[model samples]
Target: MGNCIQKTNRVVLGFDHSSGNVSQKFSRGQKKDNNYEKGNLAEWQKQKGFGNVKKTMNPPQTPSVSGCLENSHPKSHPLPTPNPISNTCHRGHKKQPSFLPLPKPEAPPSKHEESSSIGTLQPAEPSLSLYSSSFSCILPMPMSESEILSSPYLKAFSLDELRKATANFCENSLLGEGGFGCVYKGWLDVETLTAARPGSGMPVAIKKLIHSGFQGHNEWLSEVNYLGRLRHQNLVKLFGYCLDGEDRILVYEFMPGGSLEKHLFKRNSPSLSWARRIKVAVGAARGLCFLHESKSPVIYRDFKTSNILLDTEFNAKLSDFGLAKAGPTTEAQTHVTTRVMGTEGYCDPRYLTTGKLSVKCDVYSFGVVLLELLTGRRAIDETKCEEEKNLVNWVRLHVLDNGKVFRIMDTKLEGQYCKKSAYVAANIALRCVNHEQKYRPPMTYILEILENLPSNKNLNIY
Candidate 1:
């Protein structure tokens, strides 16, 4: 790699340096810090907790955990529960699935009973309506996976099939604990969804939901609706899902390379090359671009490094569509108004202010992910100094304003990365996290810039 890398190096040489437009030069992907002064937070902050802007400094800690939504860490590589993933995929031949949504739903009351307790039941229907908040009422009728998923690519998996394939959920078959439960590695005949000889069958990851909740129910629906239907190289492949009785399971293609978060944050693992990081970013951006550009746009609500899984070759694939929703449409220019939900640091402030759900929210979250990729850190770690816990705030205050991109770049990269390329990448990330949603760059443009980074590899090297 050379001393400088620029896609169409839009890095403007002689501006005020602090001006917002400086970032627009490099592939026009720069987003600025959110002082939140420009936006009208009067109504938003007027609400109970939103009012006190002063007290807003990391109140109660948004918790670095993704709850049922966080997918990586232990199960990504199957190195047991608490071990850092081995650097090489072949090192231990271990793999697991931590990327599924929702456990089984609580059973509804039987027909002849007087409805007591906090339970509601509705008509069991075959016509699937995905937007239900409480699935207990609108129980899913027994339908084959192929029947439920309109797409020819997806199949319906049965509990028996999943159980047998996973060797009856044997401990040795366990991969890792995901959002709602444990993920197990299994071998099966894809055609039959039946247990096959260990090495003879297709290798797959099965997510077994342990607990259940209303939000988890909705996320599970979201997973089935989106992952089951959409197809893209950067998006993880969903072979099928299981909804038998109280057992809710998801089946996915095995990702031997594990999660991007582990590769970046886990100790003792090899660091990803600068080129590979760029490739991963480009792949993820392409996935987002595909979603946004799809016939029906999707908002990947949870755009974090942990959700980006990799194959043996280190090709990144976007996982956990449990948080994804359809993007705002032309008719809904303002935003798709809804309850505020997302990881704290990565959430777009504008969305919280307006209760609006727009594609821009995803852009803001992706910007945070870019920041994480640039600096190997968690979005929120209680152990970190109060200010540093929130990666966005830290980057904006330190790197973006200071223009010390070199200081912020992950030291784990050692001296392998190109400084100029690093600077440009930081600019791209800054523009992405800009407080104003409009200022954030679109994934399409972002993808174009990232895709061209490889050409600049020979330009900048430490």
Candidate 2:
């Protein structure tokens, strides 16, 4: 390993860091203007080529949460009684009758037995199966709008409060925009949880939904349902939500360091050091591990660099739960069939080809993110040559060769990381991106490996 590091260092020193230009440079995946102009949803769908599938893709009416939509004022409306038989999909699709529902597992023996500290470095007991009946007590049932909004962890913010906090959503307050809507930097009073004067209150990221966008009220509710109930150190904190009339919005704790994507791929931004990179990887792994280990596991369908937000200390938190889905409930169930929705390049090929979603699909995407951290490259870089455009393919071609493994290391790292540690990290990433979904290790195992990597000094290169 010593000799290999020496040889690789010389070659790395001569490698050009500024050869290819990043072609697509958006803060988020794709940016849309925050124009609030009303447009016809049918025409918009037609222009986007969704006319052919309009029948199957029509948004299902959400009677459970429609009561809040009727009130335009900020005053608290009476909580509407939930529908007795509301088992509709989180996305606006009606539940199909073709699939039979599985029997619910009996409650766990004790709540204390199932609980574990998420912040700890130790892995869970290996004897406990992830899908065993003991863990079924945590499976989340379909939540009603009243139950979702009434979560003690989440506050119900009125539209008027958000408007005042964001200075009426002025251009200067704009943070960033994506397919769902625009996020603006806003201020809120700490103790009272009310709108505060700019520069005088705690900062927050307010996401206002776009009515015309493909994503709408359903996605908003999905986010509220998940983030409002789930709380973890590595998960982004949802301050509250607004559902006045057709206006839909979510308020989140502001991340000072912004996204990992900006630091890793954006030009002029400071490069993340080797130690900071490892820290970020571990933080993100912990977040994913927490989700997987939940009594009712959750599959974060969309796990990408842009969705990993960092705080002032660079602690990573998973954001954007709109596309999140609940994992299989019973031990007999291996996967859940759902619509394929995730970013390209980072998406699992098996999930993309067969709409069977599982926790391992997230592991595959995590591998892509690990590759990005290792090589300082985008998962899909259109600017690069044909062979190098896909990061995973390029890695497979080069990483297996012990002599060439260092060549894929981010040039900005300046050969500062441990050579053996780098080799171990690379192998971990390869195992994650394995073509066979079952071959992928669970997030717990992955987190254990990452947790040990930063301090381990005796690892062999091979």
Candidate 3:
């Protein structure tokens, strides 16, 4: 009888005399030969209590097999049955006894269960999503569609808040009426909105957009764009704006004393004193100087008393910018040609005839204002005698002669004003009104001249 044995590192397989093959795993293919000899496999089976082990010719259709072999803290076979083979001699099974079954594993806790046991979780350690949420909280809320369209500075106001501040556009809140809009006296809710008076705790003038029927859109944009960016003591500040449907409005810091025109024309009360008049004229001159000599020169196209507004202290600030134009060139002599636009007596004759506007145009208007200040007389009075009426012609005829200068001085001044300073001012006014625009001194020189004039009002009269 013959016996076959195959040895591996930790396992051994043997074939009996009756089997043709011996292996640790089962296969579907049938064995080609059956050995005729009976060998030591019988002796191995008997000693292991595996009696008369024999090979099967035909394998089962579905073989019970394991993908991998493992161990329970030690070496273990992949056989499904705990003790499938009692002896190795029959079909290459191991000689030792199989191990015991493994114990079942414990299940893990769920999210809800874990939370309940541990306590509330710290907000899912802020991820990118959390950062986005935080940013949303800190960022300003978006304005409505109407506000976005109408207000150039949309960040300044909301519709509902402005409505409340203006008492829902009440008529009693009205302050001054004009072509572009009406100015209203109203208490702003500054506590919540930055557009309101900073910390004054009082009312402000709100210049709401009126139904002018004209193309005021450009004017609205101009005011917000320029005034929104400019901050100075001599410039009127634009506080905020509202864009609620068809109603577009702008708010400005109120000027209690109103415009210079009201005082000059005596629309409200008696004319201003000579001292006050000189102060106002100089203040207005300084305002124009700032506009003309700024880093980028700004020419006041509509330079007149009406465009000058007076604050609580009677301090003058340039108010209207709708017609203000930037200088054409860097040279002080640069002139720009445009359609004639300005009040009659105040308009520069050269600018009107040649259609060429320049800083000199502003200079000419200032000359007229200076005349108003010195004589307390209207630039052109139709009611006065022909020779005495037009202020420019009157000044031209009288300024060179000293005695005629005194007669032209405001009677209200009563010879109680500074004659030397008044003469200096009149000479400056003459230069400003000179027929040749080139002969006029620059505003800086004019400012220097005015500054050097003594401000002592108590000096003895001429």
Candidate 4:
């Protein structure tokens, strides 16, 4: 029994250090490698509250929306089986074809031209006229692979330049590892965006892809397509990319505060005050709202605590666009039908069962994060008793009950927040997580509720 439990831990909860992003799920037939070392496992168990488990196991094969699934949890607390959808096969879909060949890189624009053009570009308006013109040429509608590759907004870096920036991808510089590959800490000149000494210039996070990993060129292209054009304070800034030889690398601004998942779940981290939690919640909602309200709406297929990054000031920004999809283009079309892909517990029940996705899917995910903020609990935790294993299921009743809501609030908060405000936030989460897709509030509406919560900045901290 002990060996069985140890194997289960490896298969289900393989921990990725630095960033808490869950590792990719392994298929039943694939060989299991010891990707995570024993020392790292010990540290993970200490920090995350897992006890007496040391090995990883590959569990029975289950139907996944995408051929690959992200961030799976323990088998004892398996995700609810999705109901079948008409026209959808029970077996996971095959890998889609690779994107078209990228056009040659255009000459870098003059500093003045680059600065001036960026200022004129605005978020796509409801009319979409802005997106349909010059902006639309580079947008991800039908995904013009050539236009996205040549856009002046992104810089094309040579492999040698990145080697200097990342100290040859040194082991000490590693920030985290995920399904795609490992992320490393690097530095670059603020103005020229060229490689710089370790402690001298601007810091950046470089994601270098593993050629053999589950994610591949398509996912890398998806990030460049969306983030390459869209710009907002709430979204992480993509500085550039490297496509030399078989290597695929992405450069993004370094987020000094790490991920929200660490702050909320890591044992020794400082507790986020009530006001700070509200601020983070509002910031994250704004990012999602921006994506949904765009001229060409975007569905953030993967939304979870680990993907919500923070800066030194505690401002939250959304990251990881690998699974994001473009929404329906015409009003007549209600939802986009695509492969299901997302973290296990946070995925919308409707989406998982039907493979039909819309902006409401993102709303459901936001609600799960909101609950995490209010309760300081993970979406899934095997350490707890069966009844309490799933955070959403366990808290649904308590959050709705006026008398029980307070009991569920994070004890770390120490009753510093206003009961009235807390109750209002709880109700908003309940509405967003409603099983019926239509009942879920849109990201815009959810943003309004979070922003308007009274005394958001000045909540008594004592």
Candidate 5:
């Protein structure tokens, strides 16, 4: 009986081990076998502070061993399957895809699985530029031909040419000396480069001034300032100037006939014909009118025949602007006052007495010159007898008593003067010499009467 009981217990233990509930299942077989396993589990649970309980594994099913083995790669990643139906066709297919999507990629290895994979990847390095790090690869700028040529200021003449033309400023080439400096006659090459400074077609008179710095510079500038800027038939023309270094020279057209004084009073030359004399007087009057009544009035402080220059054509130009004074503008209330310095006989007595010079002073001097032209006599002559010594006093005596006045006419003229025009001109002279400044007519009035003088050259007295 004892053997049979032991055998039954073994059978019960086997069944429990084979099949059991998760809550009450035992690894050993039968109820007795279950009690033995539970007793061992209870002892371990009591030590761990928990009741005994059975646990079961619930895992997702994987592919069959054969399918997984065929698809498995030596790299531990499954090989991608190629489907002919899904692959894009070769060229010349009727069913061309409008848009194609990228093929799905294989999954990356699990972190634990990839730990022993290929060599470790280095951190990505920063990108470097082929050109400069700070600057961009922009193109260089281009320049125009005109821009390059026009960049520099041009010179009128080359330094070498100027040096040669001035004869290296030789002392003998000197024309006239003045407060500014000496004037030199120079031969300038007409085909020079100063904004069309070509050959002057003839030698020019170059007035050069020594350096005195910029002190009183504007006044120095004013000396040739108007001459350089003015343009008229009777006015002198300034070609150019040199303001470089210690040289301040003004270039002008050379007038060949010399001045009116050279021809008028010089003993070696015969007196000008009445026709030429009248032409010169009219031309000079027109020049004075231009100065006195232009946009800017100019008073030629010295208006005697000496200052009247004659060109080759015998065209008269009023030169010697050194003593000229500009007229008053609207903003200024008074005309300029300057120290008295003028030829004695030609100076206006009213201005000499009052030291108040005006445009009328020039008109008074013009009248005196007219008298000189009429009588062919000097304003103040020392060769005559004491009674006739002073031309003004003698003229005053004769003009008051006209009977013997014709005797005082220049012997060279041989009575070649219009009697009626001479009387009118003498009356004009008498009016110009009036003691009262207001009694004298303006130069413009004298100019108007002289313009109307009979042009018939044959009406003469002998």
Candidate 6:
């Protein structure tokens, strides 16, 4: 159901389904709509008249293209009713795959388009099915490594058990390759997230890291520490991890929509309209805002498209906490200075030079990602000439140019984005990436702008 991320270049964006996409109605401290917690998705969908699906033992099949989120609640956002399809998979396990095929690599940017980070899109990897269940799990930290075996959140798995679940790490189950190593798709119980036989429980993405890298171990521990400690609708759920001697693996709630990276940058994927992009931004912002607002604030050093995973409903959930750092607790201590660590293009420019970090550093990175969504450009595009390589610089210049804001937009949008929202987004992004960290708006302020973009300010075509 809505719990799994549709791994398509999908759901139209903004946590658009498998990750935590915030239902738009709630203000800070307000309770989420209880209707969203309804037990039977098929029953709820029928009552709401969503998707026009029929009642059955298995859930209805979801669509490849995630539907749009309006200035409304989950009940009000008109779902894209997909045409009916078989609800059962081979062995009768329910498989609701909503993957759409990608188009050819877009034509490389012409030299004339100097300001837009319009690098050529690459072909997406093979599509995989995104599975979701109605159940949700809670995390309880382990007291020690021995207690990890008993921890409710960080479950321990034996090498033999993991090997069996992943079918000895078969190549066919490979989901995607990255710097860390290979990620295989595996099966687990819906509630416990413990290993289960195929078709017996829910599906999960198992990330197996090469045994030796310091970064891998640190990142794995970081993910376990943060995701294990914090619980939020907009943050990815880390069900368990394995530390079997030389084998180190992390288990996460498989995000079928993959990363916001795939949707915004991959070729052949359906384009994210203006509204959806705004939704995704707000969703990610909520996750960051939660961290900043915590009793012990956390700075998510890496806030980029790749780390934002989407669920089946295109709800955005923040994943990968390797770079998250606790903020200064005392009011007298303004910032925490440390060795700089972050993605190449999305790092806060001030943090990069000063090696001094603050909650605002995250705001800066978020500004970069926001610009990416607005312009459909990479933060750093080496393909572009020296002058146009930096997205923020280029966008900041163009955003200030009256009547030229469209020059920074993604061409694939086909002029369908809301001009007013796009302009507001650009203004926010500009403020976020300001050279001086103090000039950046707090995440809460950013949240307000995104939430009210379509409604608070009059909507005018760009």
- Expressed as tens digits, the lDDT of each residue in 1-462 for candidate 6 is 221111222221111222334422100012332344545676455454455554554543332222211222321212232222321222333332222211112232244431111111222121211122222222343456454344444566777767767778899778987666688988887665567885568777788888654346656777777766666668886767888777788878788889998999898889887667887888898788777866567899888899999987788889888778879988898799765667767776566555678999899889999999988888888779865787876774454433367899998788877775666677668767766666577886676567656542455554
Work out candidate 3's RMSD over C-alphas: 47.1
Local lDDT at 62 for model 5: 20
Report clashes for each candidate as comma-separated counts.
19, 1, 1, 4, 10, 36
Query: Taking the tens digit of each residue's C-alpha lDDT, what string does model 3 give over 1-462?
Result: 222111111112222323433323210122212222233444433443434557542222222122112222111112232222321222333322222122211223356542332222232232323211111111111244343344332245666666666676678777777666677776654444443433345566777777652326665665665554444456676666766677767777678888887887775477676667776776677667666655456677676777788876787777866666657656655877654555667777666555677898898888888887787787767779987677877775554322256777877666767766776677667667665676565665555455545555645575
Put down candidate 2 lDDT per residue, 29-139, tens digits, no spaces: 112312212334455444443344454454423222211121221221222222323223223433211111111122322334324324332323434432121221222
Higher TM-score: candidate 2 or 5?
2
Cα distance off (Å), candidate 5, residue 122: 89
lDDT of each: 0.61, 0.68, 0.57, 0.68, 0.51, 0.64
Sorted on TM-score, best first, the list reads: 4, 2, 6, 1, 3, 5
Q: How far is candidate 1 from the true structure (C-alpha RMSD, Å)?
A: 20.9
Put the candidates in lDDT order, highest first: 2, 4, 6, 1, 3, 5
Model 3 lDDT, residue 414, Cα:
69
Candidate 3 vs. true structure, TM-score: 0.61
Quote each prediction's TM-score. Answer: 0.67, 0.70, 0.61, 0.70, 0.56, 0.68
Model 5 reaches what TM-score against the true structure? 0.56
- How high is the lDDT of residue 71 in model 5? 18
After superposing candidate 4 on the true structure, give the runs of residues whose Cα lies further than 4 Å from its correct spot: 1-142, 401-403, 456-462
TM-score for predicted model 4 compared with the true structure: 0.70
Where is model 6 poorest over a 10-residue stretch in terms of lDDT? 114-123
Q: Which stretches of candidate 6 lie over 4 Å from their true place?
A: 1-151, 401-403, 455-462
* Superposition error at 82 for model 2 (Å): 48
Q: What's model 6's overall lDDT?
A: 0.64
lDDT of 2 at 14: 19
